[model samples]
Target: MPLPKAQTLFGYSPEAPELSKAEVSRRFDELMATIDSLPTRHVGASEVAQAFGEGRGIDFGARPGNAFEALTKALDGPDIAKAMSSDALASVTSALEALKAEQPDLMKDITPSSPIGTGLVAYDLEAPAKMLTPRPTPLRNRLPRKKGIGLSHQFKVISGFTGTATGGVANIHPGIGDTTQTNFAPSGASNALYYARGPKISYAGYDKTVAYSQFSVSDAVTWSAQYAGQGYQDVRQLSRTSLLYSSMLLEERMLLMGRGTSGRGFLGAVAAPTGVALTARTAAGSEVALSGFTTNVYVKVTSDAGDFGQSVLSTAANVGVTAGQVVDVTCVLPAGATGVRVYVSTGASDPGDASRWYAGRVGYNTFTLQGALPTSGVAASTITADTTAYTNGYDGILPICTGPDSGYVNRLNAVLSNTNPGSEWQTAFAALYDAVKADPDRTLLNGSDRKQLSDALKTNSSSNYRMTITQDQLTGVTLGDVVNTIINEVTGKGVAVEVHPWMPQGNAPIISDTLPLPDSEVSDVWSVFNVQDLLGVDWPVTQFAFESSSYWMGALLCYAPAWNGAITGIKKA
Candidate 1:
């Protein structure tokens, strides 16, 4: 026996299948006549069948017996030509007529019997301006604090002077009635006078000149002593130094009396001197009392000397002290002492109180001694040197994934390896797998479809398909390239395309007995066949079966198209 034709075997026999020839012929004639007489009519199945009968192979199916059936059959064709035929066109025309009859206003343009023209009119209309609501009040009205100069001073010394001198003099007694007078004066009177002439100088000198070239003695040399006493008073007013003390009392207590609630015992106090003394003493007379004292206290002292050891005197006790008690302490100013300070603490044994004591009063002074005064005419250049080591430690290895590239897998890996792995990317990958497994349209397929799908994906230029490949199948492809390919394919085919990245599968597992798939074999088959088949002509074969079962056997299938016919075949395998 002759082998059956491929067409017959495939259910498309050479002999037309048993169909109503007279009904099909009548339907074709009526549809063709209607299409020839009407505008805006679409080809129907009858037109497609008539075209087939006119020595043209039917790209679609056999003719239907009526306009509706014929149009439906034509529209279901793989190619557009069979659907755009005379009978199909006539069916569309009859549809238009029926629609016109049903809606008189819509038919008015085509109904020549009516006097109306196109039935649509253009008119200008104005839209009222929209009213705007009042703006809301601001949450805050306070302005930022302005920067101000603290304390500053400047001084200039125009001039200064010092002097030293040495000299010898002799005096002679005058006779009681002698008329001659001897005057004594310095030898360099003009020189001494000139030296004292300046803007800030004044001088006075006793004048006397004595010369002894010869000596004479009386018959009886007698020495007479003359004494004169002049009394002058040196007066000075004694100025007493005053000390000012300030203290802060910080007391904390917790009661655990009821319901066995735990309690915390704390006692802390602080005391500070307005200014430090040059010397401190433990003797009774020199000590001063601070105003505020809690169970425990801390004191800080400040002085112009900026010397902690010399200025600050502190006493502390670990045992809790009375809320208010005058602990004897002494501060003394020894002879020739310039400044002094005292710091006292009464608190827990912990050294935290000592730090606070230093900070509250003595910190500024200690800082000054270390040459850390902000006003020491120093620049901020030193801070840069200290921070250089920290800045240099930050190499490019700490990559920052920003902008569109942030979601890329490589960027995600960079973050995982170098930064934080428990980030959004990991969560996203999990979410994506979950979504794929949850999809209802996914199915199991043979290996051939997987290859075809993979190849299609590799060559397809449609961004929509590209997105499907990456997002739905988890293709691990570059997002930019995927997007570009999808765009090219969609534009080449003259079809509108929309590309959306696949959402992560979240915490859901890729495959589980509780999931929609039955077993690993089913999942494998679905990954190889169903996923690629769903990708259609826009995806690649390699994309479907790019790796062994190790890579995708247990992986969830995703990214089936909503518009695709393959969605109907998906089932639990």
Candidate 2:
């Protein structure tokens, strides 16, 4: 049937003007659909997988041959009964035919050996560790101090009579010539008039002393957790602060020694005289017998007097070599044979020296560290270290000397041989007191001494020593006995006494442990300047970080020597 006439608005018959437009539009749409059907761009395997997962349609540029999906579909269909590969089908059918042709014998079952018995394999992990106990740090907290900050310091004082005196004996004499003053053999050339003078102005000086400590680390070392518990010094867990603390102790020790660097305010002192032999050596066959040391360990044998010191290497799972091995010691020559030191080591190896072996602690040989043989078999190297005696206790403090004519009248100094300690202590005190009595600076002066003095006092002192008035005059005098007697006498006069561990030890048995000094702030006796307090900072790297800290300070005895006096050679043997 003939279609209705097309209108320009919508129909497409052919006579209307709009018919052409509408036909063109329809043709454009068909062209677009054809273009869309053609492959537009390449899609990757991932895109294919993604599309499949999304259940979306995909053309894949027309049909692809022998695809896995087609094979899979065919296998699932009725074609499953047919062999897929010629070899696989032939082998399967032949094997089936043979099975039907003849039955084969079966073999026995086999099993693998596993699930190891309880003690068969050692699966236990060994954790390596050693106990560390720090040695005593003796100097830091002991010294007496007047804590403050300032520039160079000094103590103001008055010493000798400063100016000439007047009004003693008149130069004009009323002699035999009565009223004729010149006639009394008053050649007047010998009239000497003495007058009292005002106190002399004096000052003591002190300079700063710097004390410091430092440590450093690398990143890898601190970060590795695997190394946490396996070594002698577990540096991973803690900073080795022994060095820093040691330095601090050393500074205090030096100050009290007053032996080294007299010019730098008399710091770093104390040296015993050269002994007959500072060291002793023995050939093999002399090492003492030991049993507790099981193999590698570090050991140190120090003479009780610290006159000699040494360390030895060791092997594992074994104690000392009972019969052979050279043993050398660096201490005062052993007299006859009496070991003076406590030979022991904290670990198997020397923490400060890498060359030394890991010798376990000494005294380990003793079972239970008691009974008959416990301490009986110490190393032959242990021997008595005798000390040389100084002439007197005063000698310990006199590093320098002054002349009577030097106008110092020794007033700037005090000298007294410890002749009769019981009596001389009083004399020494008197000399120091008299020297500064006029200066009026005695108020702040206190006294300090080393542990030796305290030990000496404790050793000799008795209940009677504490009781001065009721004590028997015939009682034996001990170092402590004499020292306390003197200190008690001095303290009653308003002076304070204290223990200073850094004081030089006595060279002589009687006086070695006695550097008791009447200390004072005379001008801040040790005017210390803190250039810097301990400052800790972090230095980080790509792998780890390091913690570093440092401290700086300086101390000096204010120059007023007269403000304080030390009894260097006190003896109460």
Candidate 3:
């Protein structure tokens, strides 16, 4: 059948032109040919213009089709810009302005004059500078603190034996009479026959003077500076805090080595001069070639009443000897001397030479220098001078522990050889714990002393001190952390090794116990008797500027001197 024209399909005309079957076939063929002649894929702008009319598609031969591109070309060409319509040019200009407002030119050079280039343009600065000064108060923090109602704190200590049981056991025949009754009789007919005299109890009283430290600051700073622009905001508050720290330092020194010569500071732990006195040598023995001696050396003796309590060195006696010859000296035994320590000078003629090398221990008054020369020993200068009548200050820990009263025995040599740096410390600590019969909690020494111990441990190959590495754990490697504690071989308990910067060199104090005194409580070993804690007040001002002051009043009281002791005369590692 033949198809009608497009006007007939729309019902525009019922009698629309209809062709025969051959004419209709020819028209369909011609339509298909026209569709094939058109582009099957994308064509360029010129091809599109040629395919469609120039006015309908794009004027590619004359100008760009995009309004942006056409505007850019017109800007460079005055003739093209004149030909462009005002509305089209206005639209492109509006778009460019909008873009300029939204996006800044970040690629532009930044100069010193540019406000955006400066870092402080909108920066927020911190108010005050941080304070990094180191202020450590180890002893003050550990000791107990208590309040006192009076100006002085006093306490009583038992000094002698008590009870009436001085008689010893005795054997007697069953028939005749008991010998115990006769042996237990009173002396000088002062009491009834066969009745033993009672033992009188003795006590020693001790008093501590309250000490104080104060600081003052000018009030003018408070008014002159309101903010922290100069690093500190409140000068008065800073001064108060600083005073508290400095006062603690003063108190700590008094607790350790104070010699209250001025009657202001309290007595310290190593300030007592209570060693047995040796005025002069009774016999300066003959010089012999027993050991190699390069120069003349001084000799001194220390008496011990059998207890670990060692006395201070006696007066140094100069014994002139040449190289390859050693001096042999003898002295009358001082009363109450159960044992004696012999010391020699390190080739110095000065009788008061600070360095005193340990020669040996002797039971008799006679001492013979033997073996090679000693390379390490205690320094006499480090030991504190004995105070007269103990009125200068209270006897510190060293004198109390090594004095005749406490019975502390120090039998080991005072020197530590570099070849075996850790041996003396380890042995001394172990012996100290055993003598005290308690596990020591801490061992306080100088940093140099601790370093020596640590270095010795690092080089030691003993399994007890070193760690084992296996094949299965070979990926990650570490050389082990520095050890800060040592386990007692006897008690199997670890004692913390603390390095105290303020600790006197050559003195290592072993503290067996410590208690936390939160508020007016007491410690087992020591306490701080406080007449008044840290207090501050603004002083009466006569001028326009005012002043403030802070103060602390307290004294350190050692309860049990026997429970704590020190390893003195430590020269180095």
Candidate 2 wrong stretches, greater than 4 Å: 1-227, 230-237, 240-244, 258-424, 438-491, 494-504, 507-523, 541-547, 569-573
21-129: candidate 2 lDDT, tens digit per residue = 5554553454345445544478888889877787675744433233333323433433333423333223323333343334321111122322233534555554444
lDDT by residue (1-573, candidate 3, tens digit) is 123342222212123244455644443454445445544456786778665764565433564534344434644455434544443334334444443444333222334544355633554666455678777877778777787666566665432222211112222333333343433434566565553333223233344344433222222334454343346456656665666666666556556544333355442222212232222222234433544444566667665322223455566676655545545555544323434567666454563545667766654455567556565776555445432212323334433444443323343323334455455546755665554344567777777767766776666656555455434455865544454887766667787889987664455666666522233133466676666776666777665544666566655566555555555544343
Sort the candidates on lDDT, descending order: 3, 2, 1
How does each model score on TM-score?
0.14, 0.34, 0.47
lDDT of each: 0.24, 0.31, 0.50
Off by over 4 Å in 3: 1-126, 159-177, 182-189, 196-232, 262-422, 429-439, 461-464, 469-476, 490-492, 514-523, 544-546
Residue by residue across 477-516, what tens digits does model 1's lDDT show?
Answer: 5443211111112112211111111101011111111223
RMSD of 1: 47.5
Q: In candidate 3, how many clashes are counted? A: 10
- lDDT-superior candidate, 2 or 3: 3
Q: Which candidate is the best by lDDT?
A: 3
**What is the lDDT for 201 in model 3?**
37
Name the TM-score of candidate 2.
Answer: 0.34
The lDDT, on a scale of 0 to 1, for candidate 2 is: 0.31
